[model samples]
Every structure is written in C-alpha cells, then in structure tokens.
Target: MDVTPLSLARVHFLASLGFFALFLAIALALAWVLLLFKIQARRTGAPGWTAAYRLWVRLFALAFVLALAACVPLLFQLGALWPILMERVGNVLGPLLGFAVVTVFVLKSCFLGVMLFGQRRVSDLAHTLSVGMVAAGLLLATFWLAAMVSWTHAPAGAVLVDGRYVLLDWVEAVFNPAMPWLFASLVLASALTGAFLLVGVSAWQALQRPPADAERMAFRVGLRLAGVALALQVAAATGAAQWIAQAQPAKAAAAAGYWHGGETARWVLFGWPDAAGQRNRAEMALGRLPDWWLGRSAEGGQLGLDAYSGMLPPVAATFWSFRIMVLAGLAMIVLAGLTLLRLHRRRLDPAGLPRAWLHGLSAGTWLGGLALLAGWGYMELGRQPYAVYATVTVTEAAGDIPAGLLAGSLAAHLALYGLLFAAFVRMTYHAARYGVVPVRKAGARP
Candidate 1:
C-alpha cells in the first residue's frame, strides 16, 4: 500500500485532534468539579473544601490552556488538509463552528478570569456563578462541535444541489438523530475521565501521607460519581451504537468484523479481518450475542461489509479500536464498582484499605482517557473513504499538498504533543503531592 499525502495529513490531523480532545474533556470535567468544590466551600466554610478548590483550579487552568493551544493546529489543518470540506458543507458547518468559537471566546474572556482570579475580589455567590457559567460555556461549545461532527455522519435537514450541501432546517440539522447520543456519551465519558483522575490523585496523596479531609472528600466523591456516570454510559453507548447501525450499517458491520449479512450476527470477542479474502482469518465470536442484544431473529435483516464493497471502512482498525474501547470501559466499571463496595463494607475507611488497591486505582487513572481515545478512533476510522459519509470521498476533499511537507509537519506535531503531555503529567504530579500555592503568606493582613 502506498502512503499518500492524504494519509499523512489524516494522521497529522488525528494526532492534533486527539491531543486537543483529551485536554478539552479534562477541562470540561474539572470545571464542573471545581464548581462542586466552590459550592461546598461556601456552604460549609471549611478550609478543607477551600484547599480542594484551590488545588483543582490549578489543574483546570492547565487543561484549559493546553486545550486552547492545541485547537489552533486543528483549525489550520482543516484548511490545509481538507480545504474542499468547507467548500462542500460550508453553509452548514461554518455557522456551527462559529457558534462554538463564540461560546469559547466569551466564556474564556469573561468568566474564566473571574473563576480563576476573582475568588478573592468577588463575592462568594458571584465567584460561584462564574464557575457555573464557565462550565456551561464548555458544555455549550462542546454541543456545537459535536453537532457538526454528528451532522457529517448523518446529514440531516440538508440537500445537495450539484455538489454543495444546503441547509434546510436548523432544528433538525443541529439536533439530528445521532447528535444526542454522541453528545450524551461524550459528557458521561468526560465525567468518568475527571472522576478517575480525582480518585487516583486522592489515593496517591493518601499513600504519601495520612489522609486529610480534602483527600477523603475528593476520593469519596470521585468514586461515587464515576460509578453513577458508568451506569448511565451503558444506555448512552447502546443508543449510539443502535443509531449508527441504522444510519451507517457498513460502519457498524466493519466494527463487528462482519463480512456476510445475516439475521443472527456474531458479536466478535476477538478477530482479525482479512479484507483480501472477505472474511475473518482467526475469528472468535459469540454467534448468538447480537441476536440477544439487538432483539433480532431469523426474520430480521442485517447488513454487512459485503453490501458496500468499494465503500467500506478499514475493517481491522474499526474492529480492534471498538474492542479496545469496550474492554477499557468494562474494566473501569468493574474497578469503580469494586472499590466502592469495599469502601462501603469498610465503613468508608481508607486506612483499612490495602496499598495494592490504591496502587491499582492510581495505575488505572488513564483507563477512562484510554477508552475515550479508542472510541474516537473507531468513530473516525469507521467513517473512512469519505470525508462526509456517502456525500464526498476523502480523496475528493483532500488538498493538493506534497507528501514531504505533510510528513515533516506530522513529525513536528507529534514531538510537540509529546512534550506537552509530558509536562502536564509532571506538573500535575508535583502539584498533587505538594498542594496548591497560597496567594499571600499566612500572617499577611488583608
């Protein structure tokens, strides 16, 4: 297989998007967690709650800054790599992206300063509201971005004239069938990402020193919130899958590594897709699981990759990424549930817990983040061969860029992203261990 400029550009775009997305998700989650901490601080007037708020605000600020910085490359890549995408869907995508940008700018310029710096100058209620508004802005911005992506997968309220897509109804297009499920799943995933980070950091802090009130509170809340979010994710993921299956059956079939359509589809436990032979080379699957899961029978219809020969996505990539995502999600659910149960049995005593359990929790901090990245990989790769589903092929949208130029830029992006991630981990670890810095000395007068 030849490595074309288009492939290199896609790799570069994916790398940039992944880096931006992880920080974006973390920032969104941390904003809400900060709000909770602020509310608790004001209500109880406890130093512990205040300490927690101060500690997490630093992480939130770090995430927000990185997310913002990482987004610049993606914005440029849209024009550099797939310039025709805008020409084709600019009527619909331009406004959606503009809305997202406006929300982000307004919140960052207005409320972020208040949330981070105005805690001392503003009233308690005013500061709390700022934090809440920041979270709302993040959420609103996420919805618009998600709406644009979802519309590409299932282009609703739009019609093609000659080649360009023209919008028909705003409500139907923005709130398409796939938008709700994708947005809901993303929010739940973000919550899990933040919750696990909180749990892991709090647990690590306990292991380093005796548990403080702030650590105990953070640990308990993180555990409970993770459990609740995982519970809700079950339905959100299922709904998303069912909708995708209906909207893009070829992508769904590729995820399952199904080559031949049948009423009773196999739920692949493990498999290697052989596109050349049009079958799975070393497949291991539960043949009846799909029937049970989807409520299908012999009379029901199922589509597979065979139905869309030249239009199929990369089978192995989709299949394995989906599997990784599901496996990661299940592992997190089990870990969270088990930890919660043990804590409950021990009467919520961290002192009674084994060090090994804490180590496991610490090591599992990235599981939620891993699941999120893998799920995104599956979603994006599953839409392959086309930039906008069946409407426009990627090759059609790809700009006339030289392969050498794309390769050099891709390398630079990877190097920078690696350094950024390393700095984030190192600084975060240092802060979690040492605690937040005070604005003034303990004996200083206001």
Candidate 2:
C-alpha cells in the first residue's frame, strides 16, 4: 500500500488539533477543581452537616461528571486512531492497543460512577477517593497516549509475524527510548497550564474587591503552586529539547530555520503560513538565532546533536520555544505573587497597590495564556511533515478521508465547542464575581 505524503500531512494536522482539543478539555476540568477547592475553603466555618455543604458537594459531583463526559470523546477518538496503528503495526499490535483503550475506558467509567453515587454513603472518604481515582485515570491515559506516540518515532520495536505485527517486548515497546523525555514534557505542560489557570482565577477574584483574610490566604497558596509549576515547566522544556536533538533532528532543524543547504530560512513568530516565499522565508529568518545562544561548547561547537547521523543543527527553534514558555510562565508567577503580597500587607482593602496589582495580574494572565498557546503550536508544528507518532507521514494517514466530510465535521465541532467555551467563560466569570454565598458573622450563633 503506497501512502502519499499529502495524506500523512493531513493526518498530522488533524492529530495535532485533536491533542490540543483534549488539552483544553482537561484544562477546563482542572479549572473546576480549583473553583471547588476555593468553595470548600470558604465553607470552612459552616456547620459540618449543613445544606450548604451538601450543595457544594453536589456541585463538585456534577463537575466530575462533566469532566468524565469530556474525556469520553477523547477516548473514542484515540480508539479511532487504531486503523492507522494497525497499518503500521500489522493486526496484532492493533488489538493490543485496543485492549489498552478498553481497560482505560472501564477504569474511568467505574471511577466516574463511584464519584457520582458513592459520595452520600462514604461521606468524607468520597472526596479523597474521587480525587485519587481521577488522578490515576489521567496518569494512565497519559502513559498510554505517550506510548503510542513513542511507537510513531520508533517502529522497529515491533515486527510483522503471520501477517500481523507483534510487539516483541511489550514493555520496551510501550516505554520506548523517547518515553522519558516525552513524559517529562507532558508533565511540565500540565503543571504549566494548571498554574496559569490558578493564578488567573485568583487574580480575577482578588481584583473584584479587597480579599477577605481567607481569600487572601487562598491567593497566597495559589501563588506558590504557580511558582513551582513554572519552575518545572522550564525543566521539562529543557528535557524536551534534548530529546528532540537526539531523536528528531530533522524536525528540530526545520523549526529552527536550519536546513542542509545554506539557503536563507525565515522565522515565524505569528501569523499563519503563506503560500509564497513570504511565510516560509520569514519563518526561516525569524526562527534563526546565534549559535552561542543555543549553547556552544567551550570550543564554540553546537551543544545540540546534528540531524544527520553525525551532525547537529543549530537547535534554534527549540531554544526559542523554551524561552517563550518560560518567560510567560515567570511573568504570570510574578503577577500572582505580587497580588498575594499586596493582600498580605493589609494594603489591599482600601486601595493603593491592590488595584494596580490586579490590573497587572489580569493582563499578565491573558498574555501568559497566549504565550502558552503559541508555544504549544510551535512544538506541534515544528514536527510538521511528521505526525505526532512520527511513523505515519501526514499525507498517507489522512488523504483517504474526504475533504468535504472532514470540513463538515469540523464545522459542527467548532460550533459546539465555541458555545461550550463561551458558556464556560461566562459561568466562571459570574461565579468568581458573585457566586460566593455570604457567610454569617463569626460570633452570631444561629
């Protein structure tokens, strides 16, 4: 079966888009968790067995349900990708992949059911169990996805037998050579995205009015969490760069505007790709950087490995992506920290620093969000010609699907997702501003 490059390119585009969509869904779910934690903290003074507690618990349960629903599509889409896997792995590996998906689905369903119904009977244990279960499910899903991605880059671990591909060593195949770096990168991304949400939410909350002591305390905690997450993001980006240098030198080079021929390459910081030389040349040029900036050895040698078996490219693109993600993350962390500091100083209530800090925080939050989005785009697009599981060229995998069908489906998806995104933003905004149920004065006994 001869697969053309165009088909593979289409597949690459769709898969990247799918991954981004999944990330956004997970991010939304996490935002709900952050909100729930805040509500729990605020309800601390309420009677242990009050209606308010019950209401909050019920709300959390509902949020859990929504999260589970969001994940269902993602799981199904992953399973749908099996045909392509089968093409590469033969029939045997395809079934193995399917089995993993089934296992994940069953586990997720059981956990979701437990979270929804077990709360009343289990009481305090319910929350703990729910969190643990969800976390485990998420981790497992990440691992499975990462393993599949690893297979794309290195297909040698499996061999065709009896017209079917069987993974010689399932463990080794699943945990391919690139697993560590990819996992590290994913961990960092999750932390970074999570931190951004926390800081953004806290900042928006604080800006409305002078934070109460409890609110201020929550803000402080959020700041610390964001800071730690930022640090880890930086580390993860570094590891990712190293891995790319070793395993995907060609892609790394393209991203960095360094090709075999010394033809002038342009860089692309923004805007979609253009047809002519404009976008390409601009990207190649903009993407280029000084050798030392990417880390030169003592003898001024390139620090990153070459794309060819023996020579390394400049590592320009990876370096830029790292900087963008880090800079944005740090900026957000600072804004969150300052907001907390203002509250702590007792200067937050009536005026001075709090207002200015709030403004900065809001702007910084949005800016960081944009940067994160861009960084993600760079990471995915840098691999261009190759889909995430580098084994399937973009053109071969997606060409068979009719363009009209894909377009129609995409339109429907966008409409629904747009509505969902808008509703989520509106609800979150209203909740932050007016959702807090006023507590009775501390000493007033009911």
Candidate 3:
C-alpha cells in the first residue's frame, strides 16, 4: 500500500516498458519497409516483386497487430509509472502524445486497412497511395515519439513557471537538439531492422533448394535494402554518437566505459567496465583513434563520467549494449560488403545467389536487430535514474503501485507476447514456404 522510491520493483516496471518499446521499434520498421516494397513494385513492374508484395502484406498485418498490443500498455505506463512526469509536465507532453496517437490512427491505421486487404478491391494507384501514406504516417508518428524521448535525454525549450515545467516554445521543444540526430538514426535503424529480417527469412526459404519464388524476390529486396542501409547507418550512428557526446556527456562516457575523468582516451575494442574501480578489465584499446573520431577539436578531447555532473546510468549495461550495437553495425557492413561483391560479379541474381552469401545474410539479420535493440537500450538506460534528465528522477516519478501487481503484470505481458511471437513466426513461415496467395485462395478451390 505504501509508495516506494527506486527499488528492484522500479527496475522490473522499467524493463516491461522497455520490452514493449522493442516491439514498437520492430513494427515501425516493418511499416516503412512495406512502403519500400510498394514503391519498388510500382517502379519495376516485376512479377517476382508483385508476389513478394502479397507475402509482405500478410506479414505487415501481423506486425501491425502486435504493435497495437504494445501501444496500449506503453501509453498507460507513462502515466501509471511516472505520475510526476505526466502530471507536472502534462501540459507539454500531453499534446505530443495526443498528436502521436492521432497521427498513428489517421495516417497509419486507416490506410493500412486498405493496404493489407484492398489490393484487389482498390485501383493500383490507390493501393500504392495506401502504402505510401501508412509509411508517412508512421514516420510522422515516430517523429513525435522520438521528440518526446529526445527531450527526456536532453530537456529543452521548457521553462519552470509556477514551479512546473511549461512549454515556452513548442516548436523548439519538438525540434530539440537531440531530435534531429536521434530521428535520423531511428529511421535508418528501422529500415535496417526490417530489411535484415526479410533477408534472413527469405534466405532461409531460398536454402530450401526448390525455393519459394516469392522468397527469391524478397531476398533480392532485402539484400539491396540491407546493403544500402548498412552504408548509411554508419554515418547516422557516428553523427548521433558525436552529438550525444556534446549534449549528453554522461551517457557518452558510460557508453565508452570511460569512468575516470581525463584527456587521453582509448577506444575499447572489448572489456568489462567496473564502475566501482573506475576502469576496465581485460581491456584492449586503440590508443588515439576513438578520440580522433569522436572529438570536435583537433586536440581530440574526451570527458569521462566523472567529468559529468549528473548521476551515471548503470555503467555495465551502457558499456556492453553500446559495444554490442557497434559490433553488430560493423558485422552488417561486412556482410553488406560481400553482397556488393556478389552483385558486381553477377553471382547475386534473384534467381540464384551464392549459398554461403545467403547464409551470411541470414546470420547478418540478427546483427541488425541486435543493433537496433541494443542501441535503443544503451540510450534509454543511459538516460536512466531520471525520467527527464536533470529535472525528474525515475525514483521520484514512479507511482504507489504494488510490487506484486507490477511483477504480475510484467509476467502476463511477457507470456502473451511470447505466444504472439510464436504465432507470427509460424504464419510468416507459412507465407514464405507456400506463399500467401495459395493459402488465401485455398478455400476457393472448386
């Protein structure tokens, strides 16, 4: 019955919130990729791609359903878990939340209905518009959501009026310093995640020898999308990390595992960061290159967590997650590089790609998904202890909800999602193996 400060209970609640966010991230990427598929189909007029589009329509529906499940809980968690943050800053964040929800419903839901089931009912141009509008809606919705997250990490354009946070400049708040960098990284990450998933699934199908023809088309689309996104993701990531260093130094420091305040910095190739001791163990370091890449000035200066004023997030999670995300990114680039080589050699036609290359892409799929999840966790965790960095600690924001209730809710959510995930995988496998058209029209057999 009693409210508590930060506790294990609080961590559990936060984990559930994060768990939901992961699904949303994947769903958003799927929506974007659907748009890409529609565009490609329209441009190329390839029969292979047309079949692939049908397959993706079914897959997109599954992702959309899962996203809806997560959306309800995540929206409630904001107010339920962080009463102070919602109540005090309600005036500012309320509008953002409303706008995001409206964008999702108006832009995504309405068009998505037709995109999934109206291909035959609607004109070709109308169907394409449906896909494009759904993607646009998702992008705009994500913009609002990302703006909220960016502001959480770096509170901007809000002023304390009457002892409550008030939105002085709504435009400034929406386009905060972190928003642009985070937004760019997020959009790219989504595309990469979706592409990698398609790459993996389609590659698996292709490995089946006879191969589903649609699988071949999906593989080609996935390969090109993942290859191109990998190249762009590097630039987006570098920019985001660099900007994070300037704007949220504590997070940047924790990510690099630099606990001691100093100038000469080493880029850790791998190590375990021990925050209590203020150093890394089993460390391999590139002595100067990391600073050269990350720093703005010619002197190449970097600050450790000690140099930062705010309390650091759990050093170990930030360090490992950041490294994992970076390593995943590098691995994707390598696989993508091989893809380009095959393309140049004419060995990567949709009709036939190298077996080894398909396997590599299948493996590469995990890397992109891991990168998206880990990078998100790294930032969200790095912004931790505080709901609004410098303004509201999570301990201060969490409500009086019972620990048992929170734990129970977390377990139920996880179990349900597990079942849903299994179903989705099974359905996607069916689509990949037999194709959606056969399944949908199976009942129509005379």
lDDT of each: 0.86, 0.50, 0.73
How close is every model to the real structure, measured as TM-score? 0.95, 0.69, 0.89
Cα deviation of 95, candidate 3, in Å: 0.4
Q: Residue-wise lDDT of candidate 2 within 171-214, one digit each (tens)?
A: 77777777776666665555555445445555666678765454
The residue-by-residue lDDT of candidate 3 on 126-185, one tens digit each, is 988888888778778889889888887777889867747888898888898888888888
Q: What is the C-alpha lDDT profile of model 1 across 1-446, one tens digit per residue? A: 78889779778888888888888999999999989988898889888887888888999999999999988899999988999999999999999999999999999999999998987787789989999999999999889979998898878989999899999999999998889998998889899989888988887887898888888778877888899999999989988888777777777888877787664577778979999999888788774645323322245766768778888788888889899999999999988988988889765555657899988888888888888888888888888988888889899999999999999999999999999989998888899899877755335696
Clashing pairs counted in every model:
0, 29, 0
Error of 1 at 53 (Å): 0.7
Ranking by lDDT: 1, 3, 2
| Model 1: how far residue 300 lies from native, Å | 4.4
Which has the better lDDT: candidate 2, or candidate 3? Answer: 3
